[model samples]
Target chain A: MHLYDSTIPSGNAYKVQLLLSHLHIPYAITSLNILATPPETRSSDFLAINPNGRIPVFILDDGTPLIESNAIMFYLAEGTPYLPDDKLAKAQVLQWLFFEQYSHEPYVAVWKFRTYWALNGFEDLSGREIQKLKERGQAAIDVMERHLEGREWFVGTNYSIADIALFAYTSAAEQIGFSVGPNVKAWLSRVEGTKGWVKIKKDETGKCPL
Target chain B: MHLYDSTIPSGNAYKVQLLLSHLHIPYAITSLNILATPPETRSSDFLAINPNGRIPVFILDDGTPLIESNAIMFYLAEGTPYLPDDKLAKAQVLQWLFFEQYSHEPYVAVWKFRTYWALNGFEDLSGREIQKLKERGQAAIDVMERHLEGREWFVGTNYSIADIALFAYTSAAEQIGFSVGPNVKAWLSRVEGTKGWVKIKKDETGKCPL
Candidate 1:
């Protein structure tokens, strides 16, 4: 299988890469430069693979182009030890995945884009825009900190997709100009201690080094 | 199982409510007023039920509080007609759900918050901030329009969770200050015409009349 990702370490992309590493799935990675004007993702070749033109698109061994990152994670980890067998537990995992995208990622991601991608005079950044991003981002962080109190992971008594989804951007909260807080900071360490864990940009050739 | 949902027509909350309606499951709807400063969701009583302090939290018949809207939807629909039986097909559904969160909902929901909650006056909405929001919101709408071309719903054949998730907001796009293009506007009609479909708001009790 081949995974097409981008330079920015998106939580959504990291979800796919994390699952593939944990499951020890053999896959090759291709990096696209999204920062480039008319992003490489808009190229005809990439669009043929994913009409939506987003990253963490998985090209299956049979050449099926699977676009959403969580879906790629689900496809690779289905029936594996990482996925919960209990019906309700699995739904809980999906719940956090949704939360990561809805409540969590929006705030954190826009912060990162404003600070990193949208910086450097590429386009003018207004003071009001930055203020809103910071306010929204902080609100999201507060929610995560409160929820992590006394909890090992997002789900019940185990490290599941919930951990993978949230951990992707969360570990790099500071880079986005936000803090993960004490409880969530502690939870990050616990997630890192998990066996077969991998960082977002650790590979030389973008392949699973493990 | 009983479902505790707010009176507010939240897209995320409606996901769970819609599924239960489709299944004809006996459930209770608890109206929560989020506009109440120190909202009911933030109170200690609700916190004991869900530490996350968010609405659309689902409590099972046994009093297990399931937070996150999509999580509750999947939990209710698992092994039922809502979730696709085929593996890849189901993964496709999950992909759209993730897309709804990461790409679709952020811009749509924020635009809604600004318009409905009137964040413009609550905070200073400068010309620059307004322009940026419009740009971002239109980008999101364009993406949805491109994806919806020649399709009745988000996925190819069935009206799965993807439709449910996206329908929650896209249906209300205009009210939230988003312009639904010709394609998306047509698709909205098709979605509402589905057999088990329900609208976001209720007449008096703010309960889904299904």
Candidate 2:
């Protein structure tokens, strides 16, 4: 299997990488500087693979192109311990996946992007944009903190993709000025303790050099 | 099953309603005026049901609270024809679900809300906000149109939840001033022809009275 991943340590792609490592699934990564000059993800070749033109696209052994980070994580982790077998538990995983994409990622991921990689960074953003980012991103982090209260994981008793999906961004919450509570902070450490865990590394450009 | 649905004709909740009708699953609707005088969705009582305080929250017969429209649709449609049996096909279903939430809904749904439901509608938004909404929404529609080209349904040769998830908002595209392409128009018609098809309707206050 091959992953059309990003040069930047995308939390979205990091979710997939964290699972593949935990599952010990061997796959090569094609690192594209998604935010670099000409934006490789927007290239015709990449668009042919995924018309949506996004990174963290997983190409199956049969060469089928699978897009969407949470969906790709679902595909890679299906039938594994990372994806539970019980029906509702799987829905719980899906629930967190949707939350990660809709509520969490939009705020947290964008904040991280503008804060670290973009030309303006967070400093370049409007006072309104900065306020919206902090409020929304911190709200997402607060939701995680509340969900993590009296629990070690996001979903059922085990560490599932829900943990991975949430952990991907929440791990970097502090950098985005999100003051995560002890609960969310503890959950992040627990994700790090998972088997076959691999930390998100950066390239010379300070991107997730997966 | 009791569906803690929205009275505001939310496209998100409409996805679940469409699926339940297709599956012939008996469900009672508890319609809350999410956009009512006080906005029932933000009340402490409603927050107790879903901490995120969003509508389209489905409460199962066992009183388990299932949040997130796609996740609830996945749960209600499990083992049914709306959900396919193949593994890769299932991932495709998930792919479109994520796409609908992340790509399609944000632009389209928010436009729909601001257009008709919000106090100012599109006219009230700043030039930047309106521009962002239109551009983002149109870009999402363009992606869907490209995907729908030469394809009847989003997933493997069937009208799955992917169709339902996409259809929920795309059905309202025209009202929001989006010009539908021939291919997307045909695809929307095909979705309408699915089994147990039910149209999304609005009551006196332009809300989904259920």
Candidate 3:
């Protein structure tokens, strides 16, 4: 399997890369620039593979193209220790995944996009953007922080993909100018301390698909 | 299980209501005006139940509170026909769920919010808000149109939760002032004609969560 990824770091793409490493699965990576005007993903060739023009798009062993990052994570980790055994626990996992998408990702991810990669009045990160990032983003973090106050992971007692999905962008949120209070910061360290955990970064070749 | 849902006619919430009726599971519906200023979800009481302050939160028989409409749908439908049994098929199901969250929901759902809810020019929409919605939302619909050129369902030639999730908002999209191309219109009809479907507006005397 090969992943067509973006070079510029994206938390969503990083989730897939980290999962592959954690599982010791071998794969090739290709880099694309999502920040480029008329993103490289908009190109006809890339669009042929994914009409959505997003990443990290995982081409499975049989060459099936999986576009959404969380979907790819679920595909790779299903039936493994990374996914839960109890049906309700699995539903809990999906709960967090949905939370990340609807709440955390919308606020924090876009804040990261504007503050890091696409900073400009054209994208307009002033006033309401900053306000929303602070309000909704912090609200999302508060939910996670409160949940992590006593538990080691989001769903059950183990390290599941729910943790991986939420951790991908959150660890580096400071770079995007978002704050993680004490509770979330402590949770981050706990997650990092887990075995088989890997930091999402460029490979030895200094390239990855975004 | 009792559901704190409203009759404001949300497609996301409708997915749960439809499945509950099909399964003959009794649930209570609680309606709130999500458009009201400082939306009712932000109330201290509602936040105590769901800090994320969103609607269609479900309370299980054991009093477990499940937020995120899709997560609630999964919780209700797990181990049932609503979820596929095949491994790859199930992953495909989740693939659409993730897609609905990241791509479809943000775009189509937002379009509904801005159009139907009279939220477009409100202080909430802001200038940048409309821009991102127009660009990204249109792109999302374009991708769906391309994907639906020939396929009836999103995956595996059957009516799945993916259809329910997407159909929820996509069906009511016209009321929200968004136009569905001929392809999506036909797709909507196909989904509406499926077995075990229900309209967004249930009987006025629908049970309430008390």
Give the best candidate by TM-score.
2
Ten-residue stretch with the least lDDT total in model 3 chain B: B201-210
lDDT by residue (tens digit), candidate 1, A135-166? 77777778778878888887788888778888
lDDT of 3 by residue, A93-170 (tens): 888888898889888877666555563722545676678777888788888887787787888789888998999878
Residue B13 lDDT in model 2? 83
Give the per-residue lDDT digits (tens) of candidate 1, residues B76-189.
Answer: 777886778787877888887777777767667766665655434426666766676677667767877887888777766777777788788777777656777888898888
* Candidate 3 Cα deviation (angstroms), residue A149: 2.0
| Candidate 3 Cα errors over 4 Å, as ranges | A119-123, A202-210, B33-38, B119-128, B202-210
Better of 1 and 3 by lDDT: 3
Task: Please write out the lDDT profile of model 3 over residues B110-136, one tens digit for every residue.
Answer: 665555445444456666667777677
Weakest ten-residue segment in model 1 chain B by summed lDDT: B201-210
Model 1 lDDT on a 0 to 1 scale: 0.74
Chain A TM-score, candidate 2?
0.94
Ranking by lDDT: 2, 3, 1
Tell me how far the alpha carbon of residue A180 in candidate 1 is from the true structure, in angstroms, after superposition: 4.0
The top-ranked prediction according to DockQ is 2
Error of 3 at A111 (Å): 1.9
List DockQ for all candidates: 0.61, 0.87, 0.69
